[model samples]
Target: MKDDKQLEQTEKDKRQKAIIEMIQTGKYRRQSAIVDELINQDFTAVQGTVSRDMREMKIVEGKDGSSCITTEPLQDMHRNELQRLLRENHPPITKILLFTT
Candidate 1:
């Protein structure tokens, strides 16, 4: 018989795997939707659990409004790199237009 801790871990692992599979389907656009699907699949999970799972799975939002699962989190390092690239490439805006006459 599996102990409580072991059982919990096993369940969590299973849920994580299922979450990945669901994301791969590309049918869910929101975390709540994922949770709903899990429920439909007979997996009892709350929104918080789904949200945490998404974070743990390194899920990111795509430009086309689709959710994508990545191997890395959107950490400060990536954010800093993006900021640096944007700053280096984009010109600074100097003029502010006043519409009031």
Candidate 2:
């Protein structure tokens, strides 16, 4: 049997995963929307919980004004490298492209 802390962590993990999925779907634009979707999916989520989850997940608004997860350290390194290359070889880069399916 799981302890209370363990159970709470499990639920938080599940909720955070759902948040990532909803954001990836490109249908949710705001934290309130995410909270609503979580409630619809039978997950208990409040504004404060969602906010904390997003912060822990390192989620950020993309250039296109969409929420995205920045948890990929490798991808971040590559992006930084690409930006450095562009800055050294060409003009100052204004935008970085993110391809999502």
Candidate 3:
């Protein structure tokens, strides 16, 4: 993680990782929880922001197939120091470049 002051918003890699970890850990679920966590860190993360972050992080629905968060490995997910990539649509990859690590 870089200096918190250097980050202008939650799009940052560190922030993204934190969001991923939070979702995986079940600390971020309902809108209010995410908002409260962000507020504690002086960031105003709204419900929409949380949703966008989840999407960007490629936070996937669990194997149970209900709308839930899961760290279940993406069959095609690839992660490097730069990013985590996922195939958002059929034929494997199209239209979306999400990050998840």
Instruction: List per-prediction Cα lDDT, in the order shown.
Output: 0.74, 0.79, 0.53
Worst 10 residues of 3 by lDDT: 81-90
Residue pairs with backbone overlap in model 1: none
lDDT by residue (1-101, candidate 3, tens digit) is 53565345324444555555555566566556766777677665787876676676567655553234445323212252224332223244447878999
In candidate 3, which residue pairs get closer than 3 Å at backbone N, Cα or C atoms, i.e. clash?
Answer: none
lDDT of 2 at 16: 78
User: How close is every model to the real structure, measured as TM-score?
Assistant: 0.63, 0.66, 0.46
Separate clash counts for every candidate? 0, 0, 0
Task: Report lDDT (Cα) of residue 44, candidate 3.
Answer: 56
Backbone steric clashes in candidate 1, count? 0
Top of the candidates by TM-score: 2
How well does candidate 2 match the true structure, expressed as C-alpha RMSD?
Answer: 16.5
TM-score of 3: 0.46
Model 1 TM-score is: 0.63
Compared with the true structure, what per-residue lDDT tens digits does model 1 show for residues 36-78? 9889988889999988877776777788867886755435335
